[model samples]
Target: MADRSLESEQSWKALDGEQMSALLRGSLNDYGAPPAASAEASERFRLQLEQSDQDPMDAFVEAVAGLTDAVERLAEIAAKDPLAAAASIDPSAADYAEIESLPKPIRMTVRTWLGRLLVRSRLYDEALPVIAEVDATESIDPASSLFYRGACYHALLMKQEALTDLRTLLENEDDCPIRFSRLAKLMVADIKPLKEDSLDEISRLMTDVTRRLDLGRSDEKVEGQEQKIIDKLTKLIDKLEEQQQQQQQQQQGGGSSGGDPKNGQESPMQDSQIAGGSGDGNVKKKNLGDDDGWGNLPPAERKEALQKISRDLPTHYRDAIEAYFRKRATDG
Candidate 1:
């Protein structure tokens, strides 16, 4: 009997170039040779293939001829106009159905390719469902599936999922392609130290928000992300203000005890009589200052103070803080 272990290993081995070409030719002959049947049409697709250096996966995809020509066009569109490329990814479309009808190996490969294109276009939300259709272990190009899926997960901030896929890809480091290996390492490094709601996380959220805005997506989801960033910044500012207040109080406490003890301290017992107080609950505002009048700072000093407050923040923070205050001002 043949070595069972060797046979099992060969079963999972990726298809070679000749194997892919033979499979494509067999499918073309068996499936009635779609529109790429014409010599001119075939030549057109061939010329398109020549426009790019073919990686192993790309070469396999190119061999599918007419069936995947749409994928080629989609890739081109993604490179030029990502939003248009995003809109074109309808799995229910006839071309996709035609791809689905292909042989299992070809169909899975093509589907994975489509998912990869979606990820490349930064359509992480749409990419997930497409990527889900292929089982990486069963894919002819498992490395590509893992890498692209991990990328989608990374971009979407699905840290655990991204690391899971990336680590699995790295488990076969020697066998994995060097490109995938290097990228996987970088992605792992990025995901490892990420803590939720941190400045780093906030920066990633800002990037995502910017990307959504670039795609002309100012929906409720985008609004929510913007609001989240504002909330985090407000909390940070409040914390800083509280610390400043505590430091000021500490400094004042060191030199002061001149006031009467009874005036400074509150009585534990309540007074028996109730006095007439303002039934209208409005309160007067206090204008606090050093020995000077309130709101009387020179413009240069005020601007310098504001700059000092924000000096430690990221450069883009000035714009974001201004936008936050503008919204608050409008709302108030």
Candidate 2:
């Protein structure tokens, strides 16, 4: 018998949210009135309460209250021990029939408790109908009902419904509890895009920078601003590379790459110097710094020299440089 009980418990836990709810509804429909054996047990319970000088009606009421309190406690425990709570309640228990006939308010409270418990256990589909019933009746706490329903919709991948409920709670921020309001706001933000097509915009900006630099028509201030944009683009590329590597690692079931090779920490000007001539056997090394003959040119001539140097670098290196300058202009 104990082994059979364990098997039943395992089977219940193995079911999905929809299957669990179906089983629960079926059990409620099939439940019967208290049997002769249970009636005898209740009589003994009443007699024991009477021995303490309690009125018979009061004793019965107290016993019913105690049972309700126990159910409430079990609902709380269900958050962490959903399978245990589900298995603990015998489907054939006689009292379940009486529970089906409970007052409307009491039934709503019970549904609210069960709905939240199912949600906490990650049984979103099972929670939805119960939560919806409570919400339709408008008997349960409004903030709690909204949060649970919103969370269920999110888990079920119904993004629009989730956003609507979450936003509604946020709109009445003063009426809603602080915790629920804050959570709704977080959910809404998470659903929204981080930026408006940022990658495409980055590519377009880089192209514009290349065109401007190619013209070689800039003053000292414009040249400085262009240099800053190049730096920003380099950083953006590094960040995008890191994100790609992290995704690949996750897909491969490996740990993080820890460090990505494409993430360049060196300044664009320094990188360009190294890439252009530092180690190339066929190319003559030239001092790229202002301390070299570069400082001798007038402001306009210096700017033109810098632009010619930028145009001559490899395309990938040039893009990184251009992006850095473009970012500076936007930020400034």
All models: lDDT? Answer: 0.69, 0.51
84: Cα error in model 1, Å: 6.7
Which candidate has the highest TM-score of all? Answer: 1
TM-score against native, each model: 0.60, 0.33
For model 2, residues 119-165, the per-residue Cα lDDT tens digits are 77666645776666554233234556667788777655466888877
| Candidate 2 RMSD to the real structure | 22.6
Give stretches of model 1 more than 4 Å off.
Answer: 1-15, 18-53, 65-102, 235-311, 317-319
The collision pairs in model 1 are: none
> For each candidate, how many residue pairs have backbone atoms clashing (under 3 Å)?
0, 13
Give one digit per residue, the lDDT tens place, for model 1 in 225-295. 88899888777655655555566567777556345568784333356676564569875885575776443
